[model samples]
Target chain A: MLYLIGLGLGDEKDVTLKGLEVIRSCARVYLEAYTSILTVRKETLEEFYGRELILADRETVEQEADEILRDAAVSDVALLVVGDPFGATTHSDLVLRAAKAGIQHHVIHNASIMTAVGCCGLQLYNFGETVSIVFWTDMWKPESFYDKIRRNRLSGMHTLCLLDIKVKEQSIENLMKGKKVFEPPRYMTVNQAVDQLLEIVQNRRELGEELALTENTICVGLARVGASDQKISAGTLQQLSSVDFGGPLHSLAISGCMHPLELDMLKLFAVEPSTFEQINIEDSSTYLS
Target chain B: MLYLIGLGLGDEKDVTLKGLEVIRSCARVYLEAYTSILTVRKETLEEFYGRELILADRETVEQEADEILRDAAVSDVALLVVGDPFGATTHSDLVLRAAKAGIQHHVIHNASIMTAVGCCGLQLYNFGETVSIVFWTDMWKPESFYDKIRRNRLSGMHTLCLLDIKVKEQSIENLMKGKKVFEPPRYMTVNQAVDQLLEIVQNRRELGEELALTENTICVGLARVGASDQKISAGTLQQLSSVDFGGPLHSLAISGCMHPLELDMLKLFAVEPSTFEQINIEDSSTYLS
Candidate 1:
């Protein structure tokens, strides 16, 4: 049997109890190291679960997946992921391979960042399409995510922006020269991500898209979610661009036109809470004021 | 301090290690019972975590929220919800209430059904707007979700359809008559959800909308996700509508035009795997064959 278990977003304790039981029972366990990740280290999980885990980096999975599923054809094996088993594309590939290999499999799900954003005081049902903001480079900065977010905003829906993480990624020059050199792994910070977003907005404006980061466009920034020091701040995109969220694995939410209740909640965290509370949403006058 | 913890999707063991620690330290623990739910029972979690838990039903949350958040001003409290802390709208209300009470709060994220569907061989980044499929009744069946799904499809994006869960809901007549009564909770099955989709497609066909659920429109049906008996099957909607997925908490994925890798994975699970694999997707002749 092949087992796929989710280790939720925070530290060592983020893994489900059932997942730990399976982790302990499996003779060999592999933790998928790429995709999404938990703040805890492998040693922490090892100490609590009382089992040593082999980290399966992107190379291992893309190259050695056959070996990982080979014994599953006979005995039980567990492949643990940092979030829900299917939260990333790599795990899906493993599942497809398991199906092809004809191995019976089970999945133990856990908390992932996808649903955890609701804690930032935004309605889940109100969220539009989710987009991932990747690290911008001098040669390869992409603006596709900006288009999706823009479209979602036009539809009056909340947007959940997943920040990018580069794990064991090779430098462009190293890849072209067929070298084994690696670049430092990077997790996008909320501030850097916002800077890129603002740059995209400015470019779009130059191209006549005409949308800019506005004070009333309400945005929420979360840092080190699921950790003890997880911080959530709500303000405008312009306001958020300057705040130091102070950590890795950050996510941002571009909110939609607010329901009275949602606005009330957001106001509680604003620099000027009273200003938002007095808005008479039923009339256009309040928005103009 | 208030902590919103996601229990993830399966049983009680699905709680992350971090979530468990918070639960252990919380002065008051309330499980939000309205949104999504785990397959495990309260006693099961209590036994594992060694703590008594209070169940916060819908009425208690909406009507007696004061009691739930009362002591957060002085002590640490935890509110648990199935899936992620933000998977539903009700949790947003709870977070706002905590803020209004001057209670500092943190959200511990978890995996939710929203992104977990990425396990079905769909690209997470390609999913567009998500829609909820409610269990339709004679007088209350609404079709607003159809438009949202249509909008997503038009944008060339996959749609994540969240099936409805009705727990502790009161009958319309009981509330009007001021009598205390509640209906047994119901979880919509994959079969029922697909049937509604087909109906909506038929309506669009009559209206001359270029939309329909064809025999070749690929789909994935998942049952009892994160459970030991979890099942995943991929085929056309027509074929999947007849398959017995078994058990509650099933989710469906409506695929868009596929990338080469996605097509390759989908072919592995096709009912007619050989025939599907033989086709050259870029060549019309192969599809015609």
Candidate 2:
């Protein structure tokens, strides 16, 4: 049997009791680390679970999945992933491989960031669509994600912007040069992502595209979610771009039409809610303020 | 100081080590119950954490804010949320209240469903906008969310559909009649949400509005996410509509355009990879088959 477990977000202790039990019973445990990272380290998890965990990077999972699935053919193998097993499409492939081989598998679920965005005091029901913002490279600055966020906001839905994280990713030059060079791990901070978003907004503005994203747009920044010392701050997009959230692993939310209550809650997190009123007078004074 | 901690999507053990340390040190620990529920009960968590926990319902948190915040004003009080502290926005109000009352507070993070959807083999970066699918009532079946999903799908961005959960809510008739009757808890399952989505799709089809959703469109169903018994099944929106994922808590993903690699991963989860053959077909098919 192949046991696919969700480690929940954060550290080793975040694994479900049932998942931990499965891990303990499994002959081999592999932690798929590329898709997401927990706030805790591998050593901390190993100490608590009392099992040696092999760190499975993107290459291990994507390029060498056969080895991970090799033992499952004979014995119970557990592949632990942060968040729900199906939260990332990567594990779905593992499930598929297990299915193709006719190996019975079980999935252990856990909280992922998708449903957890509600903690920012926005109504879960009111959110429109979530989008991801990637690191803008000099050669590849794709604004496609921006288009989606723009549409979501136009329809009055809150947009949760997932920041990018590059783990063990090779630079294009390295691949072309065949140098096997790897860049340092980079987790997009909420501040940096906001800066890129602002740049895109400016680009669109120059092109006369009537985009909703602006410097003073209400935005929420979250850092080190599911870890101790998680930080959440609400401010204008401009404020967020400058405000240091102080950590790796960050996310940003550009709220759409908010409820009166949501606006009130966001007010406390604002760096300059007073100045923000100029851009959103009706929402600021008429509804929430 | 008040520490709002997310327990994540699973049982008691899902709490991070950081969160646990805080819980052990805090004077009061309250679990927010209305927004979401953990697979393990309070007793289960108490047994694991070796600390008693107070389950705070919406009433306790919202109505009795004064009481919950009283101790926080003086010392450390930990408010535990099921997912990430900001996952549900419910805590934002609490956080705001604490801020206004001159109470210092901190947030402990946990993996939330927001970022966890990446596990489903979907490209986290490919997702366009996240939308919420609410439990439809006989009187209040709003289809606005459909528009948002349609918009996202049109733009070839995956949509993360957050299912609804209603707890401690009053019956409409009972409330209107001034009776103290309560309704049973209602968690929007994957099947029911899909059924409604299909109905809305059919409605749009009749109205001559080109809908991005169709019966054969690819969708990923998630249930009991972040829990030990989590299940993920990939199929057409039609096939998914008939699947009874079982138990409380469910989410759905309507995939849009896929990158070559993403399409490859998604095929691994599909009911029939051949039916999914159209997925970036130009890419090498030899390895996929």
Candidate 3:
């Protein structure tokens, strides 16, 4: 039997009671380490589960998943992910492989940034296709995410911009040199994401393109969600670019039309509640049922 | 402090370890009963948490919410939700009120249907704005959901249709007479949702409107998600309209463009895998990171 468990977005204790029980019973436990990270250390999770964990990076999950599923048919094998087991398509790919290999599998669902973004006051239902905001290199700056956000905005839908996290990634120099050296893990903060978004706005302006998002557009920045010190701040894209939301795993929401209820909830986390009063929030109450 | 904990969509054991601990220590534990439901009885959760659970229906949560948070400033109070705490705006309303009253609050994130829909093989990021499909009445048949799905299809994004569950709702006639009687809880099954969807498609055809979804369009029906007996089936809208997915809490997903990987995963749950071979699945490989 194979159990894909979600540890959720918080510390070790965020694992559901059922997930914990299933993990304890599993013969081999592999923690999917690359996609997302929990606030606690790997050792903390190891101590809580009372099991030595094998870290499964992108290479292990993508290239050597068969090894993880080898004894699953006869023994309990568990793969723990930081968020919901199915949050990333890679895990679904593994499930497809498992099904083809005739290994019975189960997924234990838990919260991911996709839904946990609701903690910042934007309703999950209001969000459109979630877009990933990747860190840009001088040579490889991409702005396709802006187009997605624009599409979502056109439909009056909020866009959840999932910030990038580069773990065990090789630099172009290292990759070409055939060296095994890896860069330190890097997590894009909300400020960095906002900067990239604003940069796109500038580029679009230079190209004489109509903008769906501008520096004045309302945006919410969230960091360390579901944690005790989790921070959420709502402001304009320009304002959020300077606010420091300390820590990793930050996410930003580029809101479209706002429901009065959403506007009310967001005011509680606003950079300046009074400033929101000055901003015209087109009511989307008609859309609410 | 008020602990707004999410009991992930399953039985009582789906509660996170942190949530269970906070719930056990809470002076008063109120389960938000109106929005959604878990598979087990309230007694089951009470016994698991070793605390008496007060069922907070709509009236209690909306009208007497102050009662739930009145003592939170001095004692630990928990308002347990069936899914993630912020899955509904009602919970966010409670949080806003808590903040206004100077009460500290915490949220424990858990899987909601929004993200758990990924189990059907469609990636979460590919999903556009989530839409609620209610049980249509003779006088209140609304086709707005179809428009939302159409917009999603235009953007090549999947649409997650959250089936409505009516609990402790009063009939319009009863309300007109000021009756205290309540109707029996009714949940919208996948079949029922498809019937309404198909009805809309027929209506659009009659009106000579552009159709974004049709009888032959691929859709996935999910029932009892995250449960031991969870069932998933993939078929066309017409095929799924008759496919019985036993019991409540069913969700439907309308496919837009399918990634080759998504197509493979959907085949595992396909009504007829051979049927998918006949469909031209436009590859969405380029959209994936």
Measured against the native two-chain assembly using Cα atoms, what DockQ does each of the candidate structures obtain, in the order listed?
0.57, 0.34, 0.74
Writing each residue's lDDT as its tens digit, candidate 1 over B1-289 gives 8888877777777777778888999998988877676777788878877898899888888888888888898998888888777674446677777777788777777778887777666777677767788998877767788787667666667777888889977888998988788888888888888888777777778889766344456677877666666777777666677888877788888776567666666665566565455445522221220
Highest TM-score: give the candidate number.
Answer: 3
Q: What range of 10 consecutive residues in model 3 chain B has the weakest lDDT sum?
A: B280-289
How well is each residue in A132-171 modelled by candidate 1, as lDDT tens digits?
8988888899989888777877777788898998988887
Q: Candidate 2's residue-wise lDDT over B1-289, tens digit each?
A: 9898878776776676667888999888887888788777789888888888888988999898878898687888888888777764456667778888999877665666766667677766556656778888788989988887777676666878888889878877888998877888899988998999999989989999866677777788987776667877787777887777888778898887766555555665676667576543422211121
Error of 1 at A164 (Å): 2.9
What TM value does model 3 have?
A: 0.95
Instruction: Name the top DockQ candidate.
Output: 3
- Clash totals, every prediction: 13, 55, 0
Runs with alpha carbons beyond 4 Å of true place in candidate 1? A169-179, A212-216, A268-289, B170-177, B212-216, B263-289
Q: Give the range where candidate 1 chain B is weakest over 10 consecutive residues by summed lDDT.
A: B280-289
Ranked candidates, highest TM-score first? 3, 1, 2
Best by lDDT: 3
Cα deviation in Å at residue B172, candidate 1? 5.0
Output the lDDT of residue B71, model 1: 84
